[model samples]
Every structure is written in structure tokens, then in C-alpha cells.
Target: MPHRLHLEQFGPVHALPVLHYRLEFAHLVREAVRRVKPDCIAIELPSTIEAPFLRAVERLPEISVIHYEGRQRRDGAESVYLLVEPADPLVEGARLALERRIPLRLVDVDTDSYPRHVEALPDSYAIHRIGLTPYYEEYRRAAASVAPGREDRRRERGMAWRLQELAKEHGSILFVCGMYHLERIKDDFGRPQAAPLERVRRQGVRLFNLHPDSCREILDEFPFISAVHELRRGPLPPEPDDRGETLRKRFSAFELIVGGRKDLPAEELLRHAVERGARHAGRGEEFPDRQRIIFRLFQEAARHYRQETGDPVHLWQKRAFFRFARNYALASGALLPDLFQLLMAARGCVDDNFAYALWRLATFYHWQRAEADIPTISISPEEIWGGSRRIRFRPRERRRKGLSHLGFLKRKKEKRPGEWLEGFTDPSICSYPPEDVLIEEYGRFLKKKGAMQLSEELSRTEPFTSSLLDGIDLRETLRNVADGRVYVRESQRAKGGVGSVVVIFDEDRENGNYPYRTTWLGEHEQESDMAFYATPPEDNIVGPGICRCEYGGFLLSYPPRRMMDVWRDPDYVFARSKPEVLLLAALDYSPEKHVVHVAARPPRSIFRQIAARMGKKIVHIPLGSLSSVKLKSIRVLHILHGHDKRQVAKDYIW
Candidate 1:
């Protein structure tokens, strides 16, 4: 009973106004057709290219383009293209008519010289919330101010004439046209209309299958959302009721169908995801909610990203992504973010690997293929949209030759399986020299930071009489502005410098994730003796002797060889978790008065008491305060089986 279903009815003709090539409008067209059940369907396409256009539509989920040479002008002859996509309302109407065996009409004037009109219209997504009738009314009010050109008027009259001619035979006709021309066409229909000048037929109009890659750049709706619409058009699997018996019955059938296929189609996977999302949201699956669809898309993309990079996308990153995307869409005057904004958000919130994963998933259309019965043509964003924006995605893993031009390079791989693992024969393992230097530098930086923090904690502020102890305390002076008295701060330096730094990347309370625990003595005075627990090195062999691992928690003590193997020593047996053990070792081994502790949360109160007993102050610095990018860069450590393996490690490492 929505106003959209009851369009502008004029006797036998019911005209439906739509924003061409929009997913919401396409849904509205399908709903309108089901409700109206008209005998004939009329669309605002030129009769000249009707054959090629219809043929393209018949291809359905596989997208196609109607290409033809336009009329020559003073500038030159230009090429015209009509994309036949499931998201297009006109194409949907024609498809419905053909499927129902109803008469189809392409009634626009056949002039190849129609000037392309670009209007700053509201996003079509608004229709989903406000209803199509209100959306169209607002658009019509704004468009009334801009008068149509002579050619537009001629086309309107020509379509009106064709509708009148068709009305003689068909009892009911459904007219689907762009909102811009609907009013003029209705006006011409009320009055007696004459056939305007137009070509009777177009020659050399051909249909071509759209190359799959081109769908990312040229499709009106991105492929992911388009595929959702296409999936909804077919018969959907039955949903479960409260009794649950029906679900069990249907699931068996579903499993049977899935068991037969070697590889499940992408659409089928998307369908399952959509249904699961809808069930979780307590919403009906009658229409696809764009917001939920995008959420599922991100989840799927994140899954792929984790599979490819072995790094999971955190919940905080997902929250940041949606927040950024929402703000970007608002800045662009859109209710929802487009493909570009989504990609930007993904890249900004996470990393290039995740962005690449999202782009790959968004551009995938199951039915599109390089080889087709019809001619396959590739197009670029520049050709279809006049201009384009660029985003660089430097994925960790290299791609094949076709994508090498897009900033992807071939990565080094072992010539044979288990070849890299053969280099692990040496008994002794040592840290890569460059990684040692990086960690040593970071330890020094942490020592300095801890000393500064300790100094701040011991600083005192008092009323200034004559001599300022250190400097005027601007904050304290401002607080006593009413008294007109100045305050000076006297900073006290710690008795001894920091000697040990403990950084906990993961608490590992269950002691499960990081299984490789070791204590290594430094080779010289420059490197700190270290104790750390990390992922098992044998799991990821980057080179023959070089294995990559991530740190869980680590303790660094200065004065090189003074520290013993803390992981094995029974002195720290009272510690509960891996991080606690490291903290205990740092407090015990630090010769200086202060020890630096970096982690997501402060160490337990018992650790502070233990540090106090050991005559050392624990300086707790939040892990989040530092740059995550820098932390990630330093987290990865490469272990070489022998010191000599460092010579060839660089070639295998990224």
C-alpha cells in the first residue's frame, strides 16, 4: 500500500519514476511490477539499440554493454555505451516483462546526440528510509527549476506518442523512465502528441560481455552489492520457524545440494552470510538492508585478510573503520559510503593488506568471466566515469603478472617445499644482527623514557620568593591567579638510571600462545642480555635457517652477561603469568633504582611491593601511547640457526 506502488496512473498507462541504475530503485521496480501485473512494459530506451540491449539483458547476472557509435557533431563522433546490469531499474523491468511473456516497448526518441546531464541529486539510498514517492517528489520539486532542452522535450513527446500507440492494444501498460523526463512525458500524453523526428533503426549496435575487472570501475553499484540484489531475485531458501523442525528438514536439503558441488559459488556463500546476519539482527530477509550487507562484506574481507597475512583484524579497528566511513560519507553528502570511501576507510583504519582483501572481495562477481560466448571488452574508470581516483595497496604477499602493474611485485619463494627448513640443522640459534640492533635501540629509548617519568614523579611545586628552583610552574601559577602568587617547580633526579626494561605485548595468562621461551646472553656491551617468550620459530621458516616469530613478552637487563637464564631459574617461580615472570626478573636484575614496564595495563600491586622490597621503582608506561606502526615493525624477530646465515637472510626477508 506504499505510495511507490501506486504510481502516476493515466487510464491504461502507469508511469513509474526511477533514478536509473540504482539498487534501491531496481528493488522498487520489481515490487511495482509484482503489484501492478501490467500486460506490457515500456522503458525509456531508444528503439534503435533495442535488439542489442534486450540481448544483453537476457544474459542476466553476467553483465553486458551495448556499444555503438554516436552521431557525429562539430567536435567528433563519440562512442555511447549502455550497461545492462541487474541493478538498473529499466533493465529489471525489461527482464520481468520478458520472463512473464509480456510485451516490451523501448519508446524513447532514437537520437544519438542526447547531451549527458549531470545533476547533483540526493543518494538513492534515501528511498529505502523515506519511501520512493517522497524521494521522487523532492527530486521533482528541485528539477522543476531547470528547464529541459529541445532534444529532451522532443524525446518526451516521442515516448508519449509511442505510449498512446501502444495503449490501443494493451489494456494495461507499465512505463518505467528516468524521473527527469517523467513529468514532461505525462504532460505530452495528456495532449495530442505527434511523433518527433528520430532514427527508425540503428545499425552496427553490438553487445559485448563486460570483462570482470572492469566491473569494479564502471558498474553503477559495486559488484558485491549488485550480486546481493541478483541473489535476492531468485527463489530463496526457506527460513526456520519457532518449532525448528522445518529448519532441520530444509538444512538437510541444503547440505545435500552443497555436498554435490566441488567449490561453492560466491553467491551461495553470500546468501548464507546474509541469512545469518538477518537472523542475528532479527530482521526479515524480504529485502536486503544495505547497511547489513556492508557489515557482512567487511567481516568476509577481514576473514580473507587474516588467511592471507596471518594477522587478525581487531574489534577496535572494525569500529574505527565504520566511524571513518560514516564521516567520509557525510562529508561527501551521501547517506552511505561508496566503494572509494570504503576502501579509504579500510586502508586508513587497518593496513594495505586488508584494503586489498576488501577490494578483491568487493569486485568479485561470480558469473563474470574472461571467456564468454559474446565479445569480451575491458574498460577503465577513466573511460566510463571521465575521471578516477587512485589508491595504492601494497599487500604483504605478491600477486601474479596481471596485477604487477598495480604496485604488486613478485615475492621470493622457496624453489621446493621444505627447502627453507633444511637450514635449521645447526644446534645453536642466534637473533638476526639487524633485529638485535633495533631491539637494543628501542631498549635504550625505553630506559630514557623511564628516567624522565621517574623525574616527573619526584618533582615538587612551591611558592616562588626570589630564586626559581627549576622554572615557573605555569599550571600551578595559573591555578593561583586570584592570589597573584607565582609557583616554581623543583625537579629531583632519580638516584640511579634505569637498567632494565620489560615490555609485555601479550600477557599470555593461560601460557598457551607463546611456547618458545629462552634467555640469551649478549655478545658485547652494546646489546642487553635478554629473556623473552615468543611464538615457536619452527612454524614460520622465512629462509633455510631464518625463522620469523612475534614477541609475547620480553625482559632486557643491561651490563650484558650479568643476567642468568630467567626462564629456567627457580628464583622467579612465584610469578603467575609470562608477563609477571618477566616483570619479576626485571625487578630482580635491574641494578639501577628504576625499572621500565610497558604493557596494556599496569602490573599487579604485588609486583610494586616486590619492586619496593628490591629497592627499585617500576615505571609503568601504557602500551597504547606509543605508535602501533612502530611497535608492529619491531615485534617481528628473525632467528638464524647460525651467525653465518645472516649473510643470505636479507634476500628471503621482506
Candidate 2:
């Protein structure tokens, strides 16, 4: 993170205008001059992009190019957009020189040498050779990456030489290049200049890095110019409410988080974050709507609190007694709090825990149904409604923000609700329970808020109790089972089959009794509660974690974990049980040898071997279990990749 006082947006210095999505390198070069005030600015752009740079420094102007060459394409259309042709970075740096009346310079390969750095020539490296000096090995590798055609690249390697040569020339010369290649680079010819930098010290050349802030600004100013910059767009997007500015400022935080993976540059991490946010949104149907609503509530509350207290402090009294606020003058990247942040931020609003609960529920939906294509919705000003003097609840029927599994599922449909709900009148009925209960009853809450759109088909039809219609309407019926009048029972005729919902009592018990309150087991459990409780035969057994079933697929624990073997073996099964998580402990042998037990069935052992060999490739078990027939015990998350000595040997290579 740059010092808060030292942030800037880029545009060409003295360029005719300022336009959104127009400026590029010129803006960056110009900003560097002001914020860094570095004696020298070294850039990392390719030598080929250097010529036009000279023109800008020389104060020469040219026409803009309308076409973009090779930006990424989606749906076969151009993804990179350029509002105005950018004055290359070289030209921008040079122009800055004239304005500041300082020396401007370019650092690149000396075209005369086929490859600028000796290190670049792997076979010809001095360090790897017999008794070659470390200096030669270092220089050899560094020079190899420079463009084989540029000559000035020598400036980096010949730093001592350049210093002595430029002793006659006074003042600092800044070198401008792209940020990506900066770290991988070394002084030209792989020279070790740090010692020389301390002992000899150069007069004309001074090196300073153009950081993430400036980098993001330059990239933010225009459309796609490189794959690297594009990656910074993450899970959440910039909002446009009062909270929007603060949210944007949060985006500036990089060093505090994943700074260890330098290989996964800041830009890449940002892009991943944005995608994750989008994925979270699109993962569920209720998320986009719920996130948007809460964000609106936050924005409204934040703005109002700021006005009352004359400070922009966070007030999360509930989750933690924590509150944070930037100087009112500072810029924020987001208009609303993130889902996590909002959990705490809600304390500033109502005393009730509903806001926090709603947010958590949405989080659970994402974690549980991670397999679903849910979309994440950024809580933007447009999505918010309550901020107005006359507050309203506008349930957007449209798809939500960052794409998630649910968002994907909803978007894939052609339905026309949740896009935007503008005109809703208060319904006279109050028989339906609260929004929380609805979501608890049904898989997800209807779109957003307690209000659910009763589809013409499902709502008016009379409830059916016939076994023939049960399978087709399982999930839907499970939803309606919340009504106390409905009771799901097993058919008396079949041993392993299910029946339908039948009224056990003539009168209603309580306002409503959700039948599906307990988690459903499986296909068998849906039809018959007995199927849910049927225990594995004592002689044979049931194991935990993933076990290649005697039959085809895999099995998992129906409810939460309540096992003894899971305690003994930690690796047998994954216990958290994420979406479609297979709890194998249920099938693993607890009392008998699985091999002997299944010896009655040969294919099962074969299947287990195949599954073990393949691991995740063969099957995915969110909850795992292992059964030891000889030990007569079942273990969940108890097994490692059952030994592949050859693969393990290869994997352990240091």
C-alpha cells in the first residue's frame, strides 16, 4: 500500500484532456513524477514499445489508433476497449522530463548483442561452468531475458561503467518500463551492482519502483492492455454510493493479505478475489438480492451516521467492539461493506441481529451449495433502495453481482423476476412465517426478502398425496412440508421404498410444523423415514469416509457426524461436509473385515482399489471415511492417498 497521502490517478502530463477509460502509460509516467519524486524511474516495458515513448518526451504529438490488436475475446467480440489511443509510456516519461526540466532515459537491451544478458544464454552461462566467477553466472542469466535486439539494455549491467561515463552529466535520469518485468530483471549483463551501488555509487542513474497504486491507476484508466492488469478485477466490484469510495480504498490493501506469494503478483490476487466474489454471488439465487439489500442498508446507515457524528467511523458493536473510518477526504474503493465486513457493520444499524443473521445465511448458502453456479452481487448504489428519504424495498429480479453457482442457475433460466421489483403493494395476508423460516423451510428464500413469487403452476394446484407423483415433486413438496398440515410417511407395501405426505391429524398443530426440518437422507430417505434409520447388518458393517462402494457410486453420512472411528483416524474422511460432501464413514467397516464382508461381492473390492488409485480423479468425497475390515473399525478422514510409492517418490523430490 502506498502512503495514504501519496495516491494518484494517471493521465498524460499536459495532454489535451481527461477522459474516463482513455489514458494509459502516459498517466502512469506522469503520476510517478509527482508522487515518487524519484531521482530515476525505471520501467519494464519491452524494447519494441520504446520508440513511441521517445516522441512524447520529445513533445511530439500523433493521431490515436482506434483498433486494438490482441486483447482477450469473449463470445468472439473484443474485450479490450480503448477510448483514446494512449501515448506510449516512453513518450509519457520523456514528456514528463520536459515539464519537470529533468533528464529522462530508457533502459533496454543493446540490439547489437544477439541476447543482451550473458545469463540468458543457458548453455553459455559462466556460473555453471568450471571455476567461472559468480559474477559471470549472475550476469549471464539476467542478460538472457532482455530483448535480443536493443542495445541500451547494457545500461542496467554497465551501471558502474554508465556511472563513470555519465559522471560528466549532472542530475538523475529516470528509466520507465512496465511493472510486470521489473522484478524478474537484474542489472544488464547479470552484473551485481548492489555492492558497487554502495561503494562506487552512480551519479546520473537512480532506480525507483512505480508501485501497485500507480500501476492500478494506469491500468484502471483504460481498457485491457495486458493480461496481468486485467487479473486485479476481483470478487467484489466498485460501488457508487457514499460507501463506494471507502470500499474502493479497501481494494488498496494488498500487503496485509497474501504478500507471501510474490509469484502470484498483486494483480493476479486481485483478479482472483473479484472472481471469487462473483462466484459467490452467482452461486445462489438469494445472494445477489440479499447482498444488494444489506449493502443499501449499510450505505444509508453510514451516510446518516457520518452526518450525525461528523465522522466516518465503522460501528460494529455486535461482532466486535471494532469501528474503523478513514479521513473523510480519503477515497474508498467500495460503496458498501463486504459480506464479511457487513456482518459487523450491521451493528451500526438496528440493535436486532436480523441483518447479521441474513448475511450469515447467505454465506452458508454459498458454502453449502458451492457446486451450484451461484453469482455474487456487489452492493452498488443502484441496487440499494432504503437510502432514499422515502425508503423502499426494491427486489431486483435480475441476476446478481459476481457470478456464483446459484447465480448461474438463475441466469440460465428465462424467468422474469428478481431482475427488478418496482411496484409492490402490501399484501393483506400475514399467515406466512418470517423470511428466515421460509429459507429454513425451503432450500432458498424466494429471490429477496420474505416475499416469494408464487408461480402460477405450483401455488394454486391442490396438494397431491399419491405415491406416483411423490418422486417428481420431492424437493417442492419438501418445501410445502413446512405447513403443519402435511406429514411425510412411508408406504406400508414396500420395505425400501418411500410414500407421500399424508395428514396425520385433522387439526393444525401450532401455526406450522416444517416436516423437512430434519435433513433428508437420500433417494430412499425421501420415500421412507425407515430407510433413513436402517442400520447396516451387524455381520457385514457400515464404514465411514469414502469407500469404493460394493456397487457403482459413493455414499456419505446423511446428517452431521456422530462417529467413534473418526476420532481414531484423522485422514480417513473429510468431515466438514461441503455441498455433495460424501461421508464415507457410514459405509466403512465398523465391525467386520470389508474384504471378507464384501468377499461375497468381488466387484466391490475392485472398485475400492480403482477409487483409491485414482483419488480425487476417480471421485470427490467432501466427507471421507475408511473402514478396516481386519480391525473391525470405521475411520472417517483416516486414509491418505493409499500408497503410490513411485508417484510419492517422484512427488517428494526436493
Candidate 3:
């Protein structure tokens, strides 16, 4: 429920002060109109531009701008523009008056040379937690310290004179004006006032439709939030309380008879789910929550990000983004973050692809169009806000264009269905050469890292008497500062070198995600013998003979062509999962006394005991210690039917 403020009243007139072009103020205006039910509605715009402004407001949900020429000065004449948007309180009040058939009054005095006034105010989102009464009282206290200029005083007196005239005919009146001029208008209403010298009528005033692309740069509130407000303004059905109620409401007897026992279509199910989510998010409340709207925006952007780049946004990234955004808002003295802060946080926490996705979603307004019923005009950020901050978003693909350019290309698809399946007729299959080189390089790096960890475990430190064995250990020397003695360290090498490396990307214990398994020996001396389990190739065919797959776990052993198919090996029958089987094969086929294992967790203790019985050791390396970017690059593998297909595979891979 909205908290009603004690507005200033004189006779039958009530004055409500508001800030211009704010969504929270618009909601307050809506609530006030419903509660007051006044016969006449008064706004702060002048009578000269009333006709064109009302016509622009009639095109609700579509934005417009009023253009005119100001008075001539010693230098030249200036162009003036007034934006008419759904998020502005003045626009909403005018729209309500027209919709409810109430008498509308435009009561401000117009002057061609009115100077622009700018003031710093707190973020309006605070009204959600703090009531509007307290918010208005605080604004009143702060605004009382500033004095009014000549034109401001004159306009306030003129509006007071109009309200006095309106009070005689109408039984009740609601006057909506700016916070800066409200106090002066209320004081002048009690005393007799005269009409000030101002422009009674203007010539050559025109209204134009705002271009859809320009909405992002000029609007005070973001396009997505404004659209949310518009959606809540219409009639809405009663929201279900739980899942059972929602199912009962959606699955009716008519639907069952018409669909004949089949499930709902995917698009219909998705729409219903979205509608339920919106209602559960409190869109039916008296005032919509800005934080909830921001949360939904991020979720929608993440979905688009996943569809565009084959990558999932992690939960940790989302937490970090909100933390960063909160601190950014605090630094700017705001209770909540704006669109610019959200974009910056997204780019800092994730990558450019996610930030680009967020930008596209934030600027989308469904009702906006390039072709409208009026003359459309394109404007820039400099024209409205006087300045803007720039950010560059470059995706993974390289192009010749600069930072200001944006272009999108359609992904290539098969000309006909089942055309790619025909390329799989060949009996033989081989791995792509480039992917093999990358995996082998990563394996060597893991082996080197494991050796260093083993060496550190064997080294010892002691006090130096005459000669140092290896070198002085600075860390130990610092610890013995009280004794005033130097510490020396001795290093010993491990007994054997690492010969096999096993990398586990995912331990699929349920045995459903990755089902494909294969074993292949190297064709040349440079490659290692490989065995792996991965996603099915038939699900993602990219080209005539090429298919892409992600590795679940893999084994790489040097000296190719010596190992048999490990997936069917009877010796490793005790293994529980595909990752365990790969670990056992690594211990069995390794030529040296040491093997490297990399995964999210260390292997079972039984594997260590089995290696000890065979006079070998398992060196565990945590998978998170490696670079995620490098790991992601090596996890993707492409298979080809024949060597001739390698020449055209580059065109199909991203």
C-alpha cells in the first residue's frame, strides 16, 4: 500500500509535489489519483504547448518529443525540446485525466528565455523501504534553504492564480507540480494574485515520434523498467498461490479435450511459466519493486548470453556482480544501482559477451517501432544529458571494425535436413590434429607441475654452521629472527618421472550425461595414446564430416599403440565411474614409477594403496589450480571421418 503524505490544502485544492521524469514519482501520482478521485487535474506545463503535448500523450507506450524555437537573444535563437515518456509523472497524470474523462488544466506561465535549473537529489528507490511522507518531508526541508529567482516566482504566482480560478467551478482539484515551486504556489494561493507578464500563445510548435534506438540514450528510466510499469498498469488475473493451484488453473477440461491427452506445446508452457514468475515477483503489488525488476533483467540477459556463446553463467559470478554493484552504488551516494553501474559490474565480473547481452536487453521496449504515425526524430546522449560515458564490447570473434561499430552474423545451418549425417558413412574416425596438439601440451604442463609439488615435499630446512647444501631458505630464516641464526635448506629429487596424465572434467556419477566412449592410438611419434568418454557426436554435427564433443574425462600415456581399449578391459572392472576407470588405466599402462592425476578432488585411498603395492606413486594436482580459459580451450574435440575433411573443418568451427 502507498503511504499518503499530508499535502498542502487551500479550500478545495490539494497540491502534490514531485520530481520530474522519475518512475517512483509516476507510481505515486497514479496512487494519488486513485485515492483522491478529483474532478479536475492540474499539471505544471504551460497552456501554449498543451494541445501538442496532450496529442503526444495519447500515443501512450510510444515515446515522443516536442520541438520549438526559443526567444532571440543578442547571439542567436536556441532550439528547445521537451521529452514525453511514460515514466514521467507529468505524462502519467495527463494520460490518467484523458482516460478518466476529467477536466485537465495546464497552469504554468511560459517564457521563451526561461533558464535551465539543475539540482542534486537522492535516488528515488528509497521510497520502497522509507514511506513517501518521510521522503517528501526531507525534500521539503532541503528545498526550503534555496531561494527562488524572478521567473520562478512569477510562474508560481501565475499557477496560484489559475488554481484559485479552478477552485470556484470544480468541487475538488488535484494540483501536481515540481517540489521547488510547490511552497511558493501554496503561499500565493491564500493571498490575491495577478497574472504575470508571460507568453499567452506560441506559434510553430511540432511533435515528433522518438526513434527506438535513441530511447537508451535520452530516457531517464531504462526501457525495460518502463515496459514493466506499462505491463502492470493493465488488467491482470489473480495470481496462484502455489504450483498445485497453477497447474489446476492451467490444465482445464477444455484444454485436455482439445489437445487430446497430449502435453502443452513448448512455447505455450514457456509463456505460462514466465507469466507465473512475473506475478510471483510482486508485479501485482501497489508499487513494483525496482530490485526485483533488476534481478529479472539479469536472468533474461544470462539466458541470451548462454544461447549466443555456448557458455553458462556460474552462480559465483552472479554473487560477485551484486556485491560489486552494491559498492559502486554506495560510492555514488545512491540506494540502488543504475543501468551504467550494472553494465560495468557485468563486464568486470564476466566477459564482453555477457555485457553485450545485458546492453541489448536493457534497451528493448516491445511497443517501440521505427515507423510510427508521426514524424520520427533521432537524438544523441549529448543532446539530452550534455555528456556520456563510453564502453567497448568486443566478442571472441575478430573483425576489422572499430569500437563504435556493431554487427551480427547469422550462424550457418545445413541446407537440408540430415545432410550432415551422410558424411558419417565412412568406417574410420580420427581426431582433429590441432586439438590433439593442445591436449598434449596441457598434459606436459600438468606433469611438470606435479613434479615440482613432489620435490617441495621432500626438501628440508636446518640451521647453517659452515656450508649451505642448496641455498638459504628465506622463509625459515625470517621465522628464526629471535635466535639470530641463519637457516639452510637441502633439496632432493623424486625417484622417478611421470609417464601418464589423467584429467577429469566431470565425474558423471548418474551415468546419463556423457555416454560415448572410445580408444585410439597415435598415428605419429609426437602424440600420446588416448582414451576418453564424451557426449554423443550425432547430437551436434557441424559440417559434412566433422562433429564437436566435450570431454568428460581422458587418459594420455606416452609411447603410443601399446595400450588396449580400457573401457572394456576386464582388469579395471572394479572401477565405479568413467573417471575412476581412466585413473586405473593410467596406473596400469604407465612406464615410469609416477603418474599425475588432476580433478576437482583427489582419487580414493584404495587407488593410492594399489599404486604403492605396484611400487608406483600417484601425484594429485587439483584441477582448479590451472587456468580456466586454457582448460576450456582443450576440452572441445572435433572428429573427422577422413583426412580429406580436415581442409574444410575450419569453416564450420567457431
Error of 3 at 276 (Å): 8.3
RMSD, candidate 1, Å: 7.3
- Please give, for residues 371-424, the per-residue lDDT of candidate 2 as tens digits: 212221122222121131112222112344775523323322112322111111
Query: Given candidate 3, what's the lDDT at residue 83?
Result: 94
Local accuracy of candidate 1 as per-residue lDDT tens digits, 1-654: 244453788869988898888888887888888778899999999888888888888898899988888888788877778899998999999999889899999998888767889888898878777787878888889999998998999899999999999999999899999999998888888889887877897788889999988987799898888877776676554552223111101112122223311334445553454444334322445577788778878987887665445455766788899999999999989989999999999999988878988887787776898899999999888777788888898755534466564332343555655556567789998888888888898989888988888889999999999889999999999999999999999999988889899998888777787989999999997888999999887655666778778898899998889888888889888878888888888888888888999998998899889888888889999886665556766787888899889888877666
Taking the tens digit of each residue's C-alpha lDDT, what string does model 3 give over 1-654? 456444667878887788888888888888878878999999999999999999999998888999888989777777778999898989989999999999999999998767788887878887777866787789889989898898898899999999999999998898889988998899999999887788888998999999988987678898877777776777553552333221111222233234322444433433333343355445446566888878877886786575455455666678888899999998998978989899999998877778878877777775777899999999888876778888887766634356323222333445655556567788799888878888999989988998998899899999999989999999999998999999999999988999899998888888886899999898889989999998777555667778777788899999899889999999999999999999999999999899999987999999999999888999998876676557777888988988777888776665
TM-score of 3: 0.81
Better of 2 and 3 by TM-score: 3
User: Worst 10-residue stretch by lDDT in candidate 2?
Assistant: 497-506
For every model shown, what is its TM-score relative to the native structure? 0.81, 0.23, 0.81
Off by more than 4 A, model 3? 4-10, 71-76, 235-280, 398-417, 446-513, 531-533, 552-559, 562-632
Question: What local lDDT does model 2 show for residue 229?
Answer: 20
Cα deviation in Å at residue 218, candidate 2?
16
What lDDT does model 2 reach? 0.27
> What lDDT does candidate 3 reach at residue 451?
92
